[model samples]
Target: MAQDWQQLNEQVTALLKTAREQVLAKMQSPLTVDEKTNRKDLVTNVDKSNEQFLIEQIHQIDPAARVLGEEGFGDTLQDLDGRVWIVDPIDGTMNFVKQRDNFAMMIGIYQDGVGQLGYIYDVMQDVLYHGGPALGGVFAGERRLKAPANIALADGLIGASGPLVVHDISHMQAIVHASAGMRVYGSAGIELINIMLGKTLGYISYLKPWDIAAGKVLLEALGCQVTTIDGQPLNMLSSNLVLVATEKAQRDILQIEEDDVSL
Candidate 1:
């Protein structure tokens, strides 16, 4: 399984590089863009094309795996009962279309509802954040990353989505008061990367499966803790306010739930 996995990783990395080239080439052309929830929630031609490309590659390797893609490009998933590949072909789609940076390609592979492998590719920077539960996480091409310290909340920086921070849901107002500082990156993949490299102490936001799937797995493998804001284990198919923190931070943050406001 290790050898097979190594080969698969190599293949997936190559594919991500190819997709990056395709994305850059397409950026020079006019975009076929549309909105889903509102005007700002955008999707572009590149998003659909990238999803198609990745799904094709996945089919070549594991045709039996059920694929859930962000662009409505795969199976209509109601449950995570089988082997599933939860994917976000372009995680920061708004940033991709507007800023041409900060977007990422992420995939979380699970077998029988248990996370196995997770990958997040920061395409523009050419950094692939990939790892498995059986193996430690990696950054750049060769550097082995160390797990973050399980720091207490008041002693560390908090990585939070801006809207959530402004609203103070889940007593995030109290959370904000307890943190050393606050940072928001608008991208789950990017935020996860910072947490993995010890740039931030924790990340919390309302996230979907494709949004937080690979990230949660990667963070957990790097000695970080991930759970719902109320301290329950994550349910893969639901959109919920998720928290990724070090062990000590999790303990401190979970206490805020007692006075948290429901959205």
Candidate 2:
């Protein structure tokens, strides 16, 4: 069957907005939270409900499409063979539950393992960053985004995972010192947004499939590099220490000299 990618993009855009409304409505009341892995890793009624809502609506739009969602409301897929949708109903669940801000809802559509369209909605800010290769370029709402300047590492701010920076993993401290500074936003979507807007030159973090999926589509469309910390292709099925940055920043990062660097 022939797929109308533009039409699919339109449908997904509307779906993201509707999911945002549902999430905001659910947040108006008290939330029931639970620990997933540890004290710091949490999930809430809002996360589960939002994932269910998104998956259900997505099936209605493309009944043949397979969905992989964080909350276990979708399929247990082992491969990305066909039309596959990866969704993080709410990224930064910790920020969402505690701060009620700095969280985003992200969705990415792929066909035969190629990204087709992506959407990341900053619910509290009411800003949506969306688009893909098929859409020509990325956009912040109706405004088309230009490619961010290819700034070098030492000349621009970098986004980093808090744990990575604190623990000095992968010579993270050295990498940060090589840059102007580091900012930890706790949400990959927000970090990606800052990069796309040219507010930050790069971001490095440990990310799962859903965490990087949507942002990958958007950033790659904008000519940014999205790769593993070692500058390898992403598996999309495995968690990785990922790097998203402009070309020059990526080169600077990959070539940073690791030595006795202190914070």
Candidate 3:
């Protein structure tokens, strides 16, 4: 079983590596950008192509595997049971089509509701944050990572979305206000990378499964907590206000938002 799982990881990693290269090769291709909900929520043909490629690979490898891809090409998943592969073919699609520097490709594999593997590829930088709780996560190009200290909200830098900071959703302003300082990266993948590196104590935002899947595995392995804003378990199929923080930071964060905050 372990060997089979390892083989799956390698196969998925190969697909991700290929997807990364394909996006890089088409980085400056003709702009076929469009909006999802608003102009800010962008998607491109590259995102579609990448997701399609990955889904095909998963189907060929494990026909029973369900893929939750960012590009609306996966199953209408209401439950996250059985073997599921959550993928963000191109995170930071806005950055991908606009600046092309801050995007990422992410994949998270779960077996019967347990996180088995996670991979986040920073295409331009060529860094892959991969591994699992079973194997312990790794940066894939560096020495073994030390799990970040269990720090409070005020102990280290925090990451958040720019709009949330301004809008003060769920008292996000108050949460970061108690922190030493706040950093808004506008890209979930980049912000998550900061948390994994122990550069930030916490990162909170309204995130979807694919948006936070890979980060969830890597950060939790580094002794961080990834859950809802109120310290509730994450619903893999639903979008919620996601909180990624150390244990000490969790209490400080849950206090910032009001009671009954999940909408």
Using lDDT as the measure, which candidate wins?
2
Please report, as a residue range, the 10-residue window in candidate 2 with the lowest summed lDDT.
254-263
User: Across residues 132-230, which tens digit of lDDT does each residue of candidate 1 receive?
Assistant: 773545555567787887789888888888878788777776787788988887788998988988888999899989998898778888888889998
What lDDT does the true structure give each of the candidates? 0.84, 0.90, 0.83
- Candidate 2 lDDT for residue 178: 87
Best by TM-score: 2
* lDDT for position 231 in model 1: 83
Model 3 TM-score, all chains together = 0.93
Runs of candidate 1 with Cα error greater than 4 angstroms are 136-139, 259-263
State each candidate's clash count: 0, 0, 0
What is the model-wide C-alpha lDDT for candidate 3?
Answer: 0.83
lDDT of 1 at 140: 51
lDDT of 3 by residue, 18-75 (tens): 7777787877679688899998999888889889988888889889989998888988
Off by over 4 Å in 2: 1-3, 257-263
For every candidate structure, what is the RMSD over all alpha carbons to the true structure, in angstroms?
A: 2.0, 1.8, 2.5
lDDT of 2 by residue, 87-112 (tens): 99989998998899999999998888
TM-score of each: 0.94, 0.96, 0.93
